[model samples]
Target chain A: MSVTYAAVQWNRQKKLYDSVIAGGVALYLGRFVGVGAMVHPQATAETLLIRGLGTAAFLLLHVVLSIGPLTRLDRRFLPLLYNRRHLGVTMFTLALGHGVFSLVQFHALGDVPPLVSLLTAPARFEQLGLAALTILFLMAATSHDFWLKLLTPPGWKRLHMLVYLAYALLVAHVSLGALQSERNPLFVGVVLTGACVVLGLHVAAWGAGRGYVEVCEVERIGENRAVLLKLGDEKIAVFRHGGKVSAISNVCAHQGGPLSEGKIVDGCVTCPWHGYQYLPETGASPPPFTEKVAVYETKVEGGKVLVSRCAKTSSI
Target chain B: MQWAEGLTTMLGVYGAAGAVFAALFLWKGVAHVDAGARGAGIGFRAVIAAGCVALWPLLAAKWVRR
Candidate 1:
């Protein structure tokens, strides 16, 4: 859905910065405590707790890493902008926790074998947990806005896309390690679903360009709000609004939000992804001058709605 | 040993703090469309917050038991 001015009015860049700072402080302070000597009911319980911490920490990082591409195509995905730093801080703390806890619980006893195990383990080790952590380590170190600003947009995107590597690593790590634990199956399923959804949204968004073009079926979804059918490589719902119902590129340019899934209000379609309102006629974003989206041409033919890939210049 | 306990407790607290921040941010965003791009970010933070919150009591309870 196209973004209207009312939607973008809630800029939270300042709030995002504050959250990041706060999260960093908490993680920083926690780092010392995680490594320090503590009270434990049993050494065994301590070991398990630390291991859990390690796993959870990695999971948090993975979640943070996945947020980028997700926000790119979807305008509503912007809220994460305010809280990304906090997420980063949380991941950092987790990685630190995992590292410290592991060091303390498994290696402190001078158990040289367990200490060496991470390095000496078979190729599978490198392919799994170790690899994931390595990617995360790189990402964490570069996470500061300073690095992001230094790196060009494309550069930042290329470097950060390593998240795919991290994601693959986490999947393997969990499949190989976590699955062995009780209730891990449930957790694994959720993780897998999440990965799929993010990936799926991306594919759908990208498909808007590469997908097959075929008019699936012409149907009236509402009064004077007719939808031109698409069912080829991509699924599009061309909304017919009054004043020459503008043909938006069917897919919510934002996160490929299903325009069909959104509602038509005030002669505009509102995206459910983030409630972006777009005038169906121009596809030009109103109010929120920040975002300008593509506008597609349309024509009503033989009582069937037809949308074009070429942009339309006629304004509403 | 005390460090380890302190670390986990802080990690949980950190998780909760991040969540509260996100929930508040998203609560406002849920009202608009520009907030959509960050939906994953908010949802993920909420999950982290919830996970941390859910496990926090258990971690604290275990400590109390000891």
Candidate 2:
């Protein structure tokens, strides 16, 4: 949304979102540690903190993962998608805290160095945790637009897709590390439920996206607005602008943001995530910017907007 | 044991180098390559510096070319 990037393009919504995140994290950690102290008087503060942070991070990761599919299912969740990276960075910080605390408590006092001890630890769970942490670090480090621009949208997306791998690793890390010692059925059930919810939502969203080429009645699309369509694996945005209907790949050239969620501004399709704009007809950014997205052929027949699955042309 | 020691030493060297490079990059080199970084506040530079620590080599290459 900015010609020049600052630390963040801070807005009222982002400030509120960050405040909520900070408050929620503080409350979760305080309540968790306090309750643990009362429940297990013998447990050390470090142990409680490690457990609290680990669980909080795990829970936040679920929320972060769910936002994508949730937004796809309903536009109401778009606000959550807007500041999702902050959630991710916060989750990484929590995970890093858990890792550091666990390392200091279990590995630091030993003769071997902590990193070496971690890698050499007999429990494969610790190694899995380390692997997941590394992936999270990579993601957190590159969360900024600087890296996105440097890596390009597709490459950056590919790197971030390793989150799925991190998620799987963390699941194994928790199951093999904590679940082995804590044979509590409730804990197991909660973990299973979180995983299932994430998986089920993704599957449901995929199903919902299918067969959207016959998008909707042309009248349903408002002027200067768009309707999202998914033909096979491609997400296309059909826009009604200037009394002409045009279709373009919904993915933005910058950061792969959903263009369909955005509206036309200055005669260009402005991305909702960031204000990256593209001419609706050509799917190319305005002059002085070189970015382009794939354009698709669209037609109005029987008052329904139909989009071609194959791109008419791609200048990406 | 030897490999771990070697890795630890290599990482230490890399970390030391990265820290130095990151400090200098934040001080001067960042603005040279990225126009957005010019006149940006310390917070922005700090974030960029964090990335610079890990990606100093790449940033260094860009700096040299610039």
Candidate 3:
């Protein structure tokens, strides 16, 4: 099983169940109960639509985007990924609601201007929403274990990084959409800040330059293959063969994830994050059109490993 | 078509939120999610299902209710 730990954690089944329950609740509230009588009764169609969209968006963002960090926070969260599709599907569903309600209220059979405005007024901000939505749609459309089996974990994860892009766009989407409406300055600000914080945490992990802990010692490594050197920052494993030792941030570029936890497969080190394969020698990915990570220069001195942190690299 | 458009749209987006959460909770683990301590760490969230039920309406009312 790609989920190496699923058998051990049987706890994942519960999360899966919980997702169903949550969806049921949303349905019950929005449809069964309607959130209409008790609240939003006199709401502008715009308000109901926006509010619904916002709630859905907020839920998906918190659940999906928070995984990488939460994993670091706790390893048990690993099960989250095993069934990540379930979560992604949930997010997409919510986002769909947000979008539809938006269309209905703001543009559903409305006069030309509202329609045009839905497309135009929120263009700048909606552009971000569009970007995030587009990516989310692609991901959701492709989020089957079938595709996961078809595409390598690396490929899957690389595609998933668009989550960051989606997130950035979403922050902009909400910031401007909510802000302009001045719906609730403090509330919008708080949500926006929270969204930024979630996204920033992921960026910070990338900035930390994780994975591939670098240890540079020129003489021993010799050029055949680069062995990893554990650094305070990361546990990098590199290989130098055919005149170039590829270097990626010691962290798995796929998830800003750790690589040390991964295994060596087919002359490449598989990333622990999502089992992405990197040629330690070239830091290049295996197939199709994946991007390569930064390569570093190493000089060996009596077993002392030295690497020039500032090195450039090309993609696959 | 209205129902299709609205229902499809709503399911497609708003319904997605939980699925997304489920993904991260499965993949990312939780804050303070130590392998040895996972049971306790996430159980807290499991319990929050109720809190969330409450929190959701509260948040919806506060922000999106309009």
Q: Write one digit per residue (lDDT tens) for candidate 3, span A265-290.
A: 76776776777877765677878737
User: Which structure among the candidates has the greatest TM-score?
Assistant: 2
Q: What TM-score is obtained for chain B in each of the predicted models? A: 0.42, 0.95, 0.35
lDDT of 1 by residue, B1-66 (tens): 344446556756777765664465335432332332334443333433333233344334433444
Per-prediction DockQ: 0.02, 0.57, 0.03
Query: Considering TM-score, where higher is better, how would the candidates rank from best to worst?
Result: 2, 3, 1
List the candidate 3 regions with Cα displacement exceeding 4 Å. A1-41, A44-50, A72-76, A111-117, A120-128, A148-159, A207-280, A283-302, A305-316, B1-66
lDDT of candidate 2 over A1-316, digit per residue (tens): 2366688989999999999999999999999999999999999999999999999999999999999999878879999999999999999999999999999999999899998888778899998999999899889988888878767778888999999999999999999999999999999999999999999999988877544267789999999999888764578889998878999989998899999999999999999998999999999999999899999888888998888655778756
Candidates 1 and 2 compared: the better one by lDDT is: 2
| lDDT per residue as tens, model 1, A205-268 | 5655342233323445454353545533334456654535455555665566766667677767
User: RMSD, each candidate, Å?
Assistant: 16.5, 6.8, 14.1
TM-score winner between 1 and 3, please give it.
Answer: 3
- lDDT by residue (B19-60, candidate 2, tens digit) is 999999989987787786777788787766667787889889
TM-score of 1: 0.43
